[model samples]
Target: MPSKKPELLVPLNGWKTLHNSSTVLDSADAFYFGLQTNFSMRARADNFPIKDLLKLIEMVHDRGKKCYLTTNILIYNTEMVELYQTIQLAHESGVDAIICHDLAAILIAKEVGIPFHVSTQANISNLLSAKFYQELGADRLILARELDLNDIKEIASKLDIPIETFVHGAMCTAVSGRCYLSAELMDFNPDFSANRGKCVQPCRRNYTLEFTGEENEKIDFEPYSGMFFNAKDLCMIGHISELIEAGISSFKVEGRMRDPEYIETTAKCYREAIDSYFNGTYSQKRVDEWLSRLSKVFNRGFHLGFYFSKPGSDDIERTIRGNQAKLRKIQIGKVTNYYPAASAVEVQLFQNHLEIGDTIIFENKNGFYHKQQVKSLQIEGESITNTKKMSTTQPIIVGIKVSKKIPNTAVIYKFIKKTTSKMKKKID
Candidate 1:
């Protein structure tokens, strides 16, 4: 392991992700989030409003964790006024640091008196490039995604500031995510620039080919036969020990548009892995378990990225078309009533049925999330084994005993393993 424990920097999109990620995983040392502005990379996400920065910062600080606001998008003269205001607000609201890509943002952060971490978009692939940013007063360097373990070690050893790198989530097929395919393909949309953070991922879509021979013979190709540009999602969990020992200062997860359950599971599993490494309990068996848990969440299959060597054809997940997630949260219904003293909730069925021994989670608009296994199911005053899956027009209310109180507005979802048995049925 490194001389100091590395920070697990999780992504935060909104209050819901923050509530789940912070509470479910104590291994999460800090959170990086984007605001509802074009200056952020995740403009399509449920980003927090600038007005709520103080409240968001306060919530994170109450849990004794640091917060980093992302102002890491390419800027233009039209966005200059808003960019300055955003950085100034971040500094005033006690954001620990601002993640920046453009030199203008770095200068603005310095002007606003906020610590800044150079974004991966800056493409600091070598020692000199890293040193260039460090000399410019960067508090940390989010190294280029193309670097290997050896390159990271060298930079981390020489740099006085912390070194951060992506440990999990989506990987861009381009070099350090500097591709213009999205911008070129989506030319009609003014905000489709990947540098501006509104990427319309045409690369991920399956493509087909057509050919015309010299004899004027036309040929058609099958759909999904060409996914040449699709890159597998990056997964470093199995190599967490190597990463911790690489002299890096922080490990960051790269999904800002993921669901709360996705955030919770990733944070919890990574925390377990990190803690196990330092506590002398890390092993192949534990790593296998963590890998299995991670596989249950949303992913496009996993690869070791460039940490080991250059990615080849095998690194591309060709078999799977889209999400390779094994687990799916099926909405059961919404909580219509709650009995606080008895620690029970009354749910009105909307889509699926619920039964004893089923795993369920309750979520509300205010970012409250509570998960529990159904120990008992009651209908009115009678106990039942299971309810039909929305069999009738009448509302079916089921009472479930919860460990804690849940809000009436909380929607219930059942975590179920995805099955391919229903795939052919839909097509047929």
Candidate 2:
């Protein structure tokens, strides 16, 4: 058993960069920001410009993390040449690599002399497909999500190329990269194989089955349905050892549509697990702790998925409601401008009331929560008797003595909003 640790790859969509920077910066070893060309038929433009894509790449790189630009959509028309040019620009802008499912785009990437990764949409499910991609100059292969653990191990043993597997996130019931759910149901096409970037995910929608009488003809089903076919998210946090021993090179987290906090927390958990495994101290308890943090986000229920085998009825969840997706707390103040001579921190409050000796917490979008106690109050560069009188917009200084360093962006709040009554009541 060769004991090399696998790399952690986090996928970032355009929307993930907005609120998840704090999280993304802290969690991912590297990131793949997705789909610059419009994949949604409903989108007005043909493509998101390379300039916009570069800004995101720069943002991710600024955080000292590696970034890969995705041009992985199926191409259908010549206009997609513009999309190819955008990938070229991403190469020039110094992205770590380009991800593409279309062979034409892969050739373009090679022509541009940039590194490339084969997208799962390429549907590399077997050793032969993996070898073909590796021979094509692909640096990594995102294995098709449909493969079982046995299949993965078999391929791993047969191939020398680096293999990346989806360790956590949603699973598509459709054949890998072959979904027409969007085009059929939403009337929008993803345009990848057709060489377009737009996609409408009709598969995630709900549908009711209808049966007709008199010769067993089918009748009209319900107009609206819930997520009947969507599988629970693939969560392998508890199975780190199995994956590490499978000879996989990278573990991927999928959430191009998720917020940054979700990206950061999930990435961090896997990173820790992989490192722990390689360091010879991997513990199930630690893995479970990391998974519990992930459960706090908005997600479908968790399952082992096809990694174990075909998902059973018990593996799918129709409804997914957890983790209040909104920010429930605000940073009231930070312990700043502390003086060793004065023995107090000049705290600034953003929106909450606090008193001397009151306990306060600071949390970021990544869900890194810490607490500090108020030792004294200060305002207008002077010690004040009443700190609670400060307005919502005002930054009131508070004096606090604590062991941990208070982060500047740390939101100081007295309470985290009770997103779940059961959890909150239990805590209470």
Candidate 3:
């Protein structure tokens, strides 16, 4: 009998990600999204407006993929009514499940008859806690990042509920991303609460390490020698088989605030790796290819985090705090007009072009995104053959028509195709 393929649960930061990025939708088995409320973990992201969430859920269901709504914020009594309402709305919208951290969220999920997946923020690290959540009607538990593979296997063996582990993306310096650094660093502002989805991310800043034995005197230390707060990003692309063999039911990629390119690249890499393993064609060369793709997006650095054993000094990245600008991809153009009847948006080029047979993403400020190829183009009502490159300092404007209409507020991005280190096709 064949083993069950572990589900790929991905993050959709906002409406743009949900609308654009076909690569993510095509490869991912399930998706998790945040709403524009204190109930979400990423309040800073362009989270889904309540009005659009219903439409998003319907679209996700229509695509035959599971959708998980995120209400993982730290809940208080004042927010309980809002939380219940959100869960009720989610249930009505056909959200397959809801991932949450607080016990209030669990109770609400249970009350609403929505399957609850325990968030990693709850920090389940042992068999006892795993069993407790399972008994509380938890459908799955996203294990804490601190757990080693052996620890995960032990919990998986002891529990009936599924064990989900993060396979890619950034790691928090604090345990389970529940750091109080932001709240403490800032002057105790209520809105800066990390659990409430407004983390200032003081940890992701340059910190000057200092040691002072006496309070009256200032000790001299290297001025901002390195970003000690920054930990290296996690990449398990090379070790997908090890994770799968360890009995993990799901592998998650962390980055709701990240761009569609990151989502697409990570999804394709992992999908290829997992499929290759199941197809009996897994190879080190294939792993290298996936790794190459993973590096092309936003990441500080990549290393396997605490999976085999405890992470050593090699795993911590003190050189920088924010994502490393390596293997970088970014916005190249913006939409200046929308022709809905013709299914096109007028694009303004800043740095790149929309050429024939080239993939482009239309990310709307009005809360929608979609991927399309440049099939046709027009300049001042004149037909032009493909590519439109900007040679001057001013933005170049042109009409673009595709399979779908793009909003006027949307900005278009051309996928920066690199010619370096071309990957060979896999042999089955």
lDDT of 1: 0.85
User: lDDT per residue, candidate 2, 170-284, as tens digits?
Assistant: 7777776467655665445344222243445445555665544455335544443455676777899989888878777888887766654566668778888877877777787
Q: TM-score of each candidate?
A: 0.91, 0.71, 0.86
lDDT of 1 by residue, 271-360 (tens): 888888898899999989988998888888899999999999988765456677787787778899999887888888877678889888
CA error at residue 419 for candidate 3, angstroms? 14
The C-alpha lDDT values of all candidates are: 0.85, 0.67, 0.81
TM-score of predicted structure 1? 0.91
- Count clashing residue pairs per candidate: 0, 28, 2
The regions of model 2 sitting more than 4 angstroms off are 13-23, 39-49, 52-65, 188-200, 215-226, 321-428
Candidate 3 displacement at residue 3 in angstroms: 1.3
Off by over 4 Å in 1: 210-224, 339-343, 364-368, 392-395, 403-409, 421-428
How well does model 2 score by local distance difference test? 0.67
Better of 2 and 3 by lDDT: 3
lDDT of 3: 0.81
Question: What is candidate 3's lDDT per residue for 254-285, written digit by digit as tens?
Answer: 99999877887788888888889899988999
